[model samples]
Target: MAAVPMDDPGRTPSSYWAATAAAGPDIPPFDGSERADIAVIGAGYTGLSAALYLAERGFSVLVLDANEPGWGASGRNNGQVVAALKHEPHEIEERFGKERGGELIRTIGEGPDLVFGLIERYGMPCDARRSGILTAAHSAASLADLQRRVDVWARRGAPLRLMSRSELESQSGTAFYPGGCIDPRGGAINPLGYARGLAAAVLQQGGHIRRQAHVRSIRRAASGWQVMLDSGSVMASRVIVGTNGYTDDLWPGLKRTFLPARTPQIVSRPLRDNLRKSILPVGQIMSDTRYLTVGVRMHADGRLHLGGGGGTAGADRPALYEQLPREARRLFPQLGDIEWEFRWSGFMAMTPDRYPRLFELAPDIAASLGYSGRGICTATIMGRELARWAAGEAAIDELVLPASSFRTLPYYALRGPIVEGTVLFHSLRGRLKTPG
Candidate 1:
């Protein structure tokens, strides 16, 4: 087999989250042959959480990563802890049937709580907040959608409330939105810091996490599964693959299951206290109903962070960098002449159905990926579920989300134009929406 090239450990991503978050301790890469009861690939939130939980149960666990923990999407997202899936509730119920749909709803509804609970339990200093998440309506059509969302989630026992335009103006400090709703279960956090904290917790529990140890291949061995690295290998009873958007050819036909999307974010120099107060006054994380999905959050250091506009990785088109700042000034004119400080992008795996996928590839091998853009909370949920499944504490079918047989996307090579055209259409639709 050809050796798999790993991400550069010496390269640092340009991100406001990474620039300010505390650094984690040094972790060495795999050197020689090793044995473990369980091995996890991709040391992001899912792998680290699985390692921590499995180690707490006295199982020998090892985690391997192409880069350090959070160096991928886990470290580069907008940091919103959204609890709901990308699809509407009615759509989910119609697709999965009432009983199973309710199960899925309850599971996703508890995602944010699980994230915050872990932080508190481990005393992780990740700038986590449970203030809430507000989905604002930019037009009358969007407001109608929010109405349906509030009613649907309320029926499922969610603490959701529909706010008036006046309430939105007061809370969000802008009149651009007609109205919206707040999900008390949703919030925000420092995603990079959270990933590092999880790694620390895993180490404290005696789990081994090896940075720069990229898996080149996985095949059955006398021990159950053999994971091949560049300079060494590991024998394990079970393996969990959580590579997400960075998934490669480690497992045959695995990376074709989803489309990798590049979402860019822009940060401003610290806004004046008055300007910060007038925008996102209550400190709630906020996003609009545009198809392109505009979102903004206030950083702990008083800088404003905003994300939108999907494009290719490392493109850094001048047009793309101007998109967020232009929208920000339009919404909050107080943000005049914004001095942009940071511009970076993260890759999220977008499934055709926009739902996360879990697979039991073989009896001893399992994988989870494609959380859409809700990884801050859903990744944690998947990690814990993976650990439980590996430990025989829960069966795959009994898990919150259904496990699906591996399905590859048709015409996967044409994803570039397809994704770009789809995003362009969404942008046009967003521009057409004006409050009635």
Candidate 2:
């Protein structure tokens, strides 16, 4: 078994998702030889969903994970399945073009559909629900910008609802938000269950899954490629590196192309029945308009998840937690009285382009990594797109989204300093305007 990295406070190690996991199976370690048509190196949504789809296509597949499936970011995410990318529509059109951009929007706008569809198909009980997502605006400028987005989403038949300050206060249980827009199409789910269930579905479809199996290196074999592991090795016709932000120096230069920013989340003790019934009366997931976005939602267990914040391990958690209280209390004053029972965080990879990166590393070897922070749905979307590309269903250019080569940040080594400095600047600027 590959050495499991010790959980850090910034890694969301004590997840409510982990607390409720339904006896994750004790799959055997990869102690011996294995060969398959395809080998997937991570068992999160991207890797597991890829395994399921490939197995459905009658390919012999093997999935290897260093830890338990869904134990990484997949299990511990905020679980908000949003419809659009963080970008606005005209911006998307301006960036990728009207046709390709429109298709990407339409494809992922149904992101929640792909999520709930799999849940229903497999009869997986993962607290899947179509509760829409509300992007709350704390300022008038943010609300105006939100209004423009609501307009574009409406034009595309996304079924959004505009909330006034009164409606926002009523729903948010706090007056801090001036207003925001409601996305009727997006929703929430138990993300850990989604990833584990995907693994289960892949196994049911006759695929092999190996936990505690970590690929240490990848090299070209004669007809295919060979992956070296801590104990044994696997040879396969194709290999996919879905490690994302968890990616390391296993392959040089890949990690530099992506910024591994750490974001954390905390969950309050389960609310009483009355508070549960009142706070999320409409059953919508929510996030705020800050540059450092705060995502909040109620779980089926009746607890509220307050998610956002940045920095690396050890030194970062307390610093980030200090920034959370005001915004959290503002969104739900009821929360001001409740102490968080659990807190954790994880790192997500972001490319300079702000889009998921897909590239062919070599002939017959490819990688689809760096989904920014939208790995749950976006990663699954890319997995399916990748399956098609692998089976020759479409060429790389024929991909639903524009394909591009990778790039690096000139100040890659200084990202940590940049994060700390930016946060300091924003806080100072806020103080200057308020004279406090």
Candidate 3:
């Protein structure tokens, strides 16, 4: 069966990233049968990064996407290059065991190094910044959690510092947060620009990317695998699925493994110079410790971008985004009246354990998704891990996240209503905890 399209599969969504990032490389759609050592589905950060690494290792790689590169969450994200996962270091270590969990924590903590290294190595002009990221606390309980996180990461020799309420107010120009913690390893980037730059690098490395080449299915062949597309097919020894939150039924039960939550973002018109300096004066990206976290960052062009939980509503509804502007005003009261220029929403997969999974769907076929909200750095690193597995440099068992079977979420069909209710509960809880 053909997969359901996510949004307009032919056109890129109108976003601040799309409006500012450079155009993607010109590539034609798949039109006939082809052979490659590796066939990858989805042309976002994960697929492109995998193909680039594979091509660099002298492997014949072909990537197929229903839309242009960076058309999905990779491009539409808030663009924060966060260096940690949804779970704290100790939590991960406790869940996965000391040895394996420690490896996971180390890998996640160093994720930003891989991201910035690639940007610098490829000369990607994504308005990349390493100013750091702040996890602000919305309440005293949240502040205690932030303190715990700081202590945990600090013990691991991470460059983290806890900020007092006064310090947070001075740095963020908002007295809303009681406290927070900053991680110097984290930063920001024009996510679409990074995605497009990765595509160009893949092309330069001799990898082929076909746009608007929606895959219909993947079937086991006499040898390797066959990727069936609307216009053509690809036969390869290995296949990687990197579709993330936009995943469909192309693979049985894959989409059911995680819940896709919509996150809506609003970008303001370039703030006046005084207002710009007053907010995020040091250029750090920030997300609070609310149950439904709110992200705040300044775009390269001086526009203020804010996003939070969007429930189950479609992106086209203007009402879905009204809360963002109000939240922005609450955070930065200095902006009495501000003009929002762009509003859009995208999905980020959520796992039961809130950790991204690497699944061995079948022999020689692997899929990775469910980054929660920390996709920018995690996805980039996941690509390199996938490439390693394909190149025989690392076995599935040796990969940082050892390959595991898919565990579909229970009551997956009711995810929409469940997520909506959860969002409502969190919204109310957050408002009560928020100081006036």
Off by over 4 Å in 2: 1-12, 313-316, 425-436
Model 3 residue 81 lDDT score = 91
> What lDDT tens digits, residue by residue, belong to model 3 across residues 101-159?
89988998999999999999989888899999988888888888888998988888998
Off by over 4 Å in 1: 1-10, 313-318, 434-436
What is the number of backbone collisions in each predicted candidate, taken in the order shown?
0, 3, 0
As a TM-score, model 1 comes out at: 0.95
* Model 1: per-residue Cα lDDT over 157-181, one tens digit each: 7889999999988998888888999
TM-score of 3: 0.97
**Residue pairs in candidate 3 whose N, alpha carbon or C atoms collide under 3 angstroms:** none
lDDT values for all models:
0.84, 0.74, 0.86
Q: In candidate 2, where is summed lDDT lowest over 10 consecutive residues? A: 1-10
> Candidates' TM-scores?
0.95, 0.92, 0.97
- Order by TM-score, highest first: 3, 1, 2
Candidate 3: lDDT of 135?
A: 85
Residue 388 of candidate 3: its Cα lDDT?
97
- Arrange candidates by lDDT, descending: 3, 1, 2
